[model samples]
Target: MMKKFGFTLAEVLITLGIVGVIAAMTIPTFVTNSQNKANAAKLASTISNIENAFGIMMVQEGANTLDETEFYQYLTNKDLEKAESTFGEYLKLQGNGTVTNFYGEDKPFKYIGYSAVPENITLSESIDVYQTKNGALLMFADGFNEITEDVAKKYGISVTKQYFLLRIDVNGKENPNIIGRDVFVFALCEDGALYPFGGKTSSVIQTGNPTSRHYKNSSGSYACIDGKFSAGCTARLIENNFVVDY
Candidate 1:
């Protein structure tokens, strides 16, 4: 027989063990990467759908200032009426005025398809259409109306207050400047100016919390919109198709 180039049993076992160890370490990483990529694709697709609907609505209505309800209504009423669409089917607005689909649940307009699910999204809360005293809208969670009196007192704002231009910054903390008040509004001006209305500025604004900003402070990472922290800003903007100037 040709001098066997193949390794002996012991040597082969050792090599196999090493290969197994490497594979064990890399498989989870690969899976995680794959999941992230899939989620990204889904998000992009959803955003495109939403933007397309918005574009249609704008063309028909001759305006770009539609509320969350109006946007959904446009999709379900007009877009779906004309074209059989996936997003319209996925977003089954309920009789109680809530919307549901593959995503968990949403409180109207605060967040639409913003949560992270393997295949769907959940709405974070309802949108606050009011403005704050400082001219910034109280942009945060949608369940603001459900906050307890003590919690409201702690934040120095009421549950009925609304915020505009909400930003869960890189630190994952809600900007204190936008907390509390009614009628929050952040206008993305034609000149590319971001203006916040309502709420007062405090000298010591807390920053960095995963709940609000969705990033660990020690990591020095920035807040990600829609629970995706690793993607670029342009990708996010393009996906959402909404102006997130924060």
Candidate 2:
């Protein structure tokens, strides 16, 4: 007759310990990768929604260009209420179309390292916030500046007119609402295109190329600095095929 086939207590413990070690080594990495993928997807969808809303609004308003739309004028004039309301109408917002000031008392966004806040992002200025039906919060700021002659020469792009600035929270009011994480910044260019903030230019959007020249993927002002707020991280993420490697 065969003896007891099962391993002794020591052998069983050893095997279990090996399995535990393997799991411990891999679980956190797996979880992080999964979260990164989810964030990337959410960001992609948000971008598409915002762009589509603008396109639809332009069509309905009988406007051939974004400058012809009321939203553009409102933004130019820094009229938060009208700009936010127009966006709400175009996007078919679920709640009351209200544009709230998310400035002054407390800011909704946080740095990558909340406790050790960095100066990469400035929240002292006023910003207009609107929550979309999809749970993404759009923060609008009249932060655009004309691409100076020096900047044009450096990037080699002919873009002169600066457009709107958008700080978006892909997960709405969820935890870890930090820039370069759930929050991202973009430049809504006069060309009716959105480019990752800190990017060299909007040529990446205009050309439909992921690997474009002078486009800040993971470098320059928009680089994804560890434990710091980097608004241009959005462009870096997009250039890296939505992979949140950082």
Candidate 3:
């Protein structure tokens, strides 16, 4: 008789209801956390791929030093056609998919927000943009500074020395495309390989130059905070191997 003792039907139902409530409260948080982790991994993989490719090409060309313009001559063109030829034809990649020298699409990219867009221009509208199969975005203009050649001349800089910007939309045009959260700026120096905008954060890159200036802004919060943009976190996350710490 004692062994038959158990909770009544009403008590069991109450217990189940409490369990459901707890799940409802926690599931969304868990889902978000999981997605963030996966996105972080994607960011790491994507940037690493680009960096490695650049290194291999440089070594093959036997180049010890290359300015931005020379790098493009060694790598891509105005339309990055050579990039497609090597990375696509030979490497069997989607050629990282070519993009035009135009801004947003006749179909705008679904996720148009930029967490850390530069102080210089419009996020999606001002730059020529391209998207890759891995969900990363390549944004560059004809010259530097602005999307026109005049700007480069005004700055006395060529397109090669000015460098290009990368916005990695972890989900690729998906919703909640907040910059820094879903996107980060991976800036490639005109003369150096790709590194997060705030390059000093990378131990490997900043190794001997403790006093060297990599990024002017030093905000390192994972999410764009205090009105700070996502670009600030690029070097931070890159140095951390693309694992964003909350």
Candidate 4:
């Protein structure tokens, strides 16, 4: 009979060492990739729901314009009762999900810049602060602001309705709420369309360019890019197919 011999102890130990080294090198990368993918999915889902809400509102309301008040009525009507306070009347929410409000001493959100750096931002209590059922925190505020003639042309669009901004934290109550990281910003135009930070006009539709008039990707910083919202990283995130740059 042919003699069969097991590998020596030294060979086994060497093989195990190599395996351990490979695992050590690749495990963190695998984890990071998995987490990033999860965050991206959450962001995409939130954006889709918001867009669908607006689309449905347009179909039902038979109108093309939306104020902050009207938009939430269609967007987050179901969770109206759960909020601490609202600026305008809410009629119905497109989905039957819960939205909890947080303001005052209980506020659980923070601000950040496009470079995924934290910032000092004192949020006015007048704004609405709420967390969606999908674990997204929405910092919403709406009002009309004047735009200079030069600014309008530079943004590649004519003046529109009262400006409404939405800053979203894809994973509510999670750490690293930095914009361009877990959080992103968006603008709901009076025309009833949702645009990313860098103006969704004919000239620039989600251009991640750092020099965009609406807002550009911050270099080693995260400052509110749009004249209205902070960080302006959403435009770049969208341009990058919803991938967050570390």
Candidate 5:
């Protein structure tokens, strides 16, 4: 009697079809969420590694502030090679070279479809690139504000500090080469602090106060908005405890 109560072939097929439809609808979203979490973790790890290395370097050099360290000296002198080499020494790097050398054949990074880019500079330019042992790419560039001032002014923002901008590609040469996703930016300040690009204000830096999570624009109609320049996304991510919600 129990066997006779079982569903007919058509009913079973219909049930299976509905299940398949549900799976199809949900699987991609699940996969995307998992990937986002993984990227966020990777980015947080890289940031921790960098801060630790900077701390260790300062301790080893008997320097209390980053500006006193030789690494900062190299950066101030615009000696990117020495800056990269010295900082690279502090961290565990697999290799260092031009962007093309490291990002070969990978799809060039986009701004998550947000048209505004840094200083209108090419994202895939031949910048100094370093790959960590964990496979994150660290790209260093100088004149953070001067280079990005035009775009900053467009949004009623200005970062008039002597800082170097660091671009981190959390997953080196990997897919989803999108800013605010796989790519983030940080500012190496003259005060020897590393800050998310849009974190500290000009007044805060001027006052010698410690940087805080006061990102001026991390939401809609401001910086880090989905369809806007994403330079502030780093600060946004940090504000969210490294969660990749946006």
Candidate 6:
């Protein structure tokens, strides 16, 4: 014989089994890492698109002052429905594109997606808008209806006011359905900055006060309170500073 260069059948089987075990252990880890990377990329891309839209609106308006209504109308007129759809598709979330009393929808005025909903929470709108000193529109929201101390502990970050920003203009000289009283919608946040759950709240309509906005539950209480609604409510800017092309 040729000195038995290869192992016996039993030996080969043992070797193959070891390889399979190793593969099973590492494959899931690799898959999970890949998923996280993809999600992060999608988030960054969505943010960039929104920023670009705002920039365009600002240039058209000739100034960087806008209200929530102006922003919504501008988006609708421009037919930027892709922004919301892209987000939902990438996140594997189902949303309606119509304005409704609930939070998550696929409406042209609502950016709906899944977030960390708390226990015993009802559906509600949690939108906020702000105007920056540098002519930028800042919007923010809480991904969850309420960030309880226990939940905050689980995330390893203190439950703060989560939010996002959309810098645009609303002078109305550029488009119709634009131009409105500049409103600064503020929310009560004792924790920290508002968390913007990507473009999930982009298509939502502006409920509550346009000046000082607060999320309310089905019972008409602040949606940020624990035990009021589910924990997965996402905070976002339904509409921000944006000018329309009149």
TM-score, every prediction: 0.37, 0.74, 0.63, 0.63, 0.75, 0.38
lDDT string for model 6 (1-246, tens) is: 566587889999999999999999999977755543443343344444444554454455453332222443433343334433432222222222221222132121211122333333322233232322232233333332334455445445443332232312221112111111121123212222222321222112122121122233334322323332211122323323121110
Point out where model 1 deviates above 4 Å.
1-5, 68-246
Residue 43 CA displacement from its true place in model 2, Å: 1.3
RMSD of 5: 6.0
Candidates' lDDT values, in order? 0.31, 0.67, 0.51, 0.55, 0.69, 0.32
Q: Which ten residues in a row have the lowest lDDT in candidate 5?
A: 202-211
The lDDT of model 1 is 0.31
The candidate that wins on lDDT is 5
- Pitting candidate 2 against candidate 5, the one with the higher lDDT is 5
RMSD of each: 14.1, 5.1, 7.8, 6.5, 6.0, 15.9
lDDT of 4 by residue, 164-190 (tens): 667777787576555555767666666
Better of 1 and 5 by TM-score: 5
lDDT of 3 by residue, 1-246 (tens): 367778999999999999999999999998877877787887777666766666665566665533423446634354455545544421224333323233223332322243333445444343444455665565543333222445344434333233455556666666555555566665454444554654542212222222233433444322323445445556666667667663
- Candidates arranged by lDDT, highest first: 5, 2, 4, 3, 6, 1
Q: Whose TM-score is higher: candidate 1's or candidate 4's?
A: 4
**80, model 3: CA deviation in Å?**
4.6
**How well is each residue in 1-246 modelled by candidate 5, as lDDT tens digits?**
354567889999999999999999999999978888898999888988898888889888899666688877885665666777888778988777767777674336676664545555564444567789899998877644432545445445444454666889988988777778888877765444566755655324423322332345444322666566565677778879988776
Please state the error at residue 33 of candidate 3 in Å. 1.7
Instruction: Choose 4 or 5, whichever is better by lDDT.
Output: 5
How well does model 5 score by local distance difference test? 0.69
